[model samples]
Target chain A: MSATYTAAATLPEALAALASGARPVAGGTDLVVGARQGKAPLPDSLVAIHGLAELRGIAETGGGGLRIGALVSHADLVAHPAVRERYTALADASAIVGSHATRHVGTLGGNVMNASPAMETGGPLICFGAEAVLVSESGERRVAVADLLTGPGRTAARPDELLVAIELPAAAGGSCYARLEYRRQMEIAVVGATCAVTLEGARIGSARVAITALTPRIVRVPDAESALAGGDGGAGAVQAAGDAAAAAAQPISDVRASADYRRAMAAVIARRAVTAAIARARGSSDSVPIPASPALHGADRD
Target chain B: MRYDAVLNVNGTDFPVEIEPHRSLLSVVRTELGMPGSKEGCDDSECGACMMLLDGRPVNSCSYLALQADGRKIVTVEGLADGGELHPLQRQFLAQGGVQCGFCTPGMLISAKALLDQNPAPSEDEIRIALSGNLCRCTGYQGIVRAVQAAAAEIA
Candidate 1:
């Protein structure tokens, strides 16, 4: 048997429902799958917030940034023209998640809230300086995306808190995400890296490098970020940054791959991701391939 | 406790009393007696339970029935009209896409979703669209031809 369910029609209703101690469900891609597998029984009560109109959309923040609602489906993210032109890394990450069917059904909020260490969105979100906005009966608080997850399958969000949306700063320059997987599509990332570089004249002004699945949790490679900050965006400097990222990675041997192999692949992937980001920052076309999840020909766009 | 909900399936609505844990696939098959959708690897790894939710394909095995309340659902049964086979189904039969037939319903639903979004897709696009749906028989050659043929007819 499973827990009871409640559908919240409004934000206040959802918050009120959460007050009664119910697990918040949006998209239900992860929760329903986990429930079916008996990973954990469905909580005593589940509050569905998917129908709340307030929780869905991608909007431009007054500050010239973007506020992506928690319920924005991955399909929506990939097809957004603003996202493709600016937040290319986030777009690339969203495009590669699962298959077209899953992307149509999964939400960005669910991906971050699930707090999976190997999640494709986590690395890109952290590199782009994103923030998570959570609401509860006590009110709302904003937390840095990097600080949202404390461990695998764990989050800093309180039991009563609902992640309302994710806010991202204006895209600075060229950014891209790349992951190493056994298959080309529909596979979990073994080792992934995301890079956002702002070229200052001939030198790199600012750079952020983040890696996933190679540690207990996804983390920003500050050592690598600093190493590439003022250097020329050349192959030599990129190789050094990759070395730093590999050194910072703390991976454990698992059924997927050995620790040594993961550590080595982390460096290789970081190098490739940084190279692509640098190319895009220099006003080059995106080097990442589109996953065909969203057909641009259709008139159904936001 | 069972709650009453209305599920609009294939242009018709069926009111059902279901538990919170019941999946859309279970209710559609057991409660509504429309087994056009199959239950493969219930965890969503297999696409045998694929169905259209509000014009988008999803794994019904992992989708809660209550979550689908008031939403339009299209199963494999809905692909045909007035006993006439859908072009994709016709092509599948002609191109040998139906081998084991166990994976046909899901494959047809996935193909229908793809064709709806993209009337004419390349071989690579078709492969990527059907990547989620797996078939151990026919080696995907016939399936690929079936989709291409259907697209040609639709275009």
Candidate 2:
């Protein structure tokens, strides 16, 4: 197991190394866990990007959208004041992505590049109209985040390409990402939905919805988006949009969730997410991400 | 595949070489002789093996010793200063946060990181933050109280 270890000081250097056949490692949370369980082989070389703190931040970008660096952690997502305030849906999605420990080390870029259908980054990112920024030895290009994932644990990214950053367009200031998972931390999403909506005086202007884990790749249900456009952004509208989104999904049977159950939860969660986004758009910026404040501790199961 | 890597554990640096198959938990207990971080599950789900990796809690059982190269790490044994218990360590004892004592170190590390970032986090926030770490005894009531109590102390 002779592996070349490289610590990238900049994104360009990292991209170049990746193009030259070096394995890119960021945070190494997911990859490490899988490796520990013998589910993967440690690549001969590990290009560590944890040293590049520049790639780990949440801030308002010059382009008027939120630019989440590849190294941003789940904890960083929850703790960032800017993220918790405006794009809280992203934070909410990050909070339940894993346990406190896992969240601290898991990187958003890793989640995106890993391309798991139930990837925590997929739904919320899609909700925000996020773009995937890829870099190569030749140059750099941007792709829609929705277009990045091809299927479960698959991506359209070239083997020699490295995902550098995730650019999420500012969705007129209100958005929400939600999903149903069997376990709060360990389970993958059964059906994930991201909704971004802009409201003009109780009337919805435009809406974007991306559903993950319930299909081959995350697909926007335009029929559901239409249901949310002219409606009052009220409970009924949200429910209808969720129903359409669920109806529009082409989920497969898997261990985590049945197709029927996923379809049902797809509607339920999409409606809930859209409703939540609308509520945030109405100025509930300080709303907490969790459902209940009750404290529950883990008791030993073994 | 053994290579000498610098591991900054509990503030001090130690040069060590380990097999790629070795876990950080085993390294901490055997090589370094710091056993505060337990290896209850040998899996990532249990917080019993939690430690601070660059100020963030991570399960050491699933963590390879090679991953700690040139990184700062903190174990439960490092929580005290000059033989004095950390507030969380002391508070866990006061509130019976430790029933089985197996999950205490991991719980404390997770709670410590949470409090380090958020000093006055709400009860629900505490639960959500520490949900991944498991405690078999006391049904987590005392553990949650211990975290809340520690938060109060830190505040």
Candidate 3:
């Protein structure tokens, strides 16, 4: 149990608390629930940063990119017009995270910093080339989202650092995040894939393919990206990308699914993600909804 | 160590001194004398401890009471106005939404939050809104009907 707690009024105060070894709590969806589930004990000391106005709101950065504050809730992301229109993949991931109540309170910073390989938003952030802005009493530094997440329930951030914001570069082309879920709500991804592709006429110019719940960390598959790039963005290219993702997968058996099953589903989910992304790139947004998972059901058989 | 704070619930402010680890649900039920919210999973998976914090639905079981300091909280007990049943409460009974009544409080709170945001929610919207609240007895059909009826009555 936490022996002491203080609600920080500003960024400097929160950073100072962290510098003193007090864990920062925002939303408390993960920290408090993890303690209840026996996953980890409550930190001896905590500083509530949820009330800090400096770490809130989403704003358009220079070059049409987005700077998302750490305290911005998942519901806020889902409700944002830019997130739904430009960062559709992120919207897809956020829209399906936990349930209504969870999304209303859960913060993107908490989700990213928690470093769960199965988290819904990590793959999209990685595909979009987002950056984690870390701040401490010393200074501020930005780390790539992919590098910031080191392992399950762990991050590269020091105990004295706090993730203040996530910065996404201007979105290009189209992207989609699809996960194999057992239920509609309050579900984590069993196996998920995110594909962001920019089409040059009929050919795919560039692509980013990331697999989730299939590796120790959510990672972009270079082999899968190579399979889709410079290709016709057709069935053959999509299949090759899926196969490459499956080959790159190193999943573990757990209560959700066996390692082999996750590996098999990785290819299916990746293919669906790529297909939806390509369709959106081709200006066919009606082909896939904000969350491509449910809309792309039975797509693998095709 | 216990932290002293005030939680405004249902337009009333109550001063409380609670431990840092105590949940908003525990503080409301034990300290504030409001036992309407149920603790189903103690974890956030079951929304039996759902409450409105600053007009947004949150799983109070996982919300730290210290974080709720000076924030407006709305429990199910606050739903009714002066011995009059809220539209949601009346609709739940009229639609047979309650079976065991274990999840009713959370369901009502969730429904209220949903209606407050979107007054004319479709069936799918209502289901998605109540997805966090688990009802083992009613199987959720009656609950869905109750939310829809309440929305109609309110609008």
Candidate with the greatest lDDT versus the true structure:
3
| DockQ-best of 1 and 3 | 3
> Candidate 3, residues B52-150: lDDT per residue as tens digits?
999989999999998999999999999999899999999999999999898999999999999999999999789877888899999899999999999
lDDT of 3 by residue, A211-259 (tens): 9999999999999999999999989999999999999999999999999
lDDT tens per residue, model 2, B1-155: 56788899989999998765567789989999998889886657778899998898888887767778888999998899978999999988988888778888998898999899889989877877778888888787887888888888777
Clashes (backbone N, CA, C under 3 Å), per candidate, total: 0, 5, 0
lDDT of 2 by residue, A101-216 (tens): 87777888888887877776687777777888887777778998878887766888887787767887755757777777655665467788888788878888888887878887
- Which candidate's DockQ is highest? 3
Give the DockQ (2 decimals) of all models.
Answer: 0.64, 0.51, 0.77
TM-score of each model, in listed order:
0.95, 0.89, 0.96
Best-performing candidate as measured by TM-score: 3
Model 1 ranges off by over 4 Å = A287-302
For every candidate, the chain B TM-score is 0.98, 0.96, 0.98
lDDT score of residue B131 within candidate 1: 83
Q: Rate the local accuracy (lDDT) of all candidates.
A: 0.87, 0.78, 0.90
Let me know the TM-score candidate 1 reaches against the reference structure.
Answer: 0.95
Model 1: colliding residue pairs: none
Give the range of the ten consecutive residues with the poorest summed lDDT in model 1 chain A: A293-302
Better of 1 and 3 by TM-score: 3
User: In model 3, what are the clashing residue pairs, if there are any?
Assistant: none
